[model samples]
Target: MVVLMRRRLVWALAFVLVLSLTGQEDTAKKPARTISIVAERFFFSPSKIKVKEGETVEFVLTSDDTDHGFHVPAAGIDVAIPPSGKGEARVRFTAIKKGNFRFECSRACGAGHNLMRGEIIVR
Candidate 1:
């Protein structure tokens, strides 16, 4: 009877350990969410965005009329968006900080290039 009880305890402990490890694995393997942005001559569609801290995000930038750029100084993200129907630029970064990060057009598109700006709010 003593030996049987010891075996049962060992199995129970092993099962609990496996369950804990699997839970951690699922969290670690969580997929990142993708956000698409459309850039025009003077503005970005959906200029404001919100994300959770410690979550990963992927940005897909595309142009409508001319060549534009995406620049996020705080997050170290910089990419050039091609012209309409040409192609797109993609960037991925983890939101580690909790604040607002500004993004703007890196390339001079036109006279209103300065107005082309957006913000990513991380909470």
Candidate 2:
């Protein structure tokens, strides 16, 4: 009976530890908010983004067809989305500079690769 009680106690302790760690992770890495961006043949839908200083934005990106990329050199963010798929990448920065930053696809897709660009304004 003593061995059985000890086993139960150990399991209870493990469960509590797992719960606490999960809660901490949830709070620590939570994004300030989420923004959705769509990539098509040659453009990003909602081609312009605006955010405040110190705001952490999670970008949910999807491709209309084939594959495309989202890259912001100034912010050092580059992510690729599978065609018409759901996934997210995050950017967390204190907007030390306030202006227009141009982001483009670092990956070559087709004839419009060079023209695939967008802007982010940080205020």
lDDT of the candidates, in the order given: 0.78, 0.68
List residue ranges in candidate 2 displaced over 4 A. Answer: 1-29, 86-94
Root-mean-square deviation of Cα positions for candidate 2 versus the true structure, in angstroms: 12.3
In the range 1-123, model 2's lDDT, one tens digit per residue, is 999678556645644554454345355555678788888889988899897865656666677876677788886656555555433333343355778889887668899989999888888
Error of 2 at 9 (Å): 39
RMSD (Cα, Å) for all candidates, in order, is 18.6, 12.3
lDDT of 2 at 9: 68
Q: Native-vs-model 1 lDDT?
A: 0.78
* Candidate 1, RMSD to the unseen true structure: 18.6
After TM-score superposition, the amount by which residue 113's alpha carbon in candidate 2 deviates from its true location, in angstroms, is 1.0
- Per-residue alpha-carbon lDDT of candidate 1 for residues 44-102, written as tens digits (9 for 90 to 100): 98799898998877677788988888888996566767678766666665788899999
What is the C-alpha local distance difference test score of candidate 2? Answer: 0.68
Q: Which structure among the candidates has the greatest TM-score?
A: 1
Error of 2 at 118 (Å): 0.5
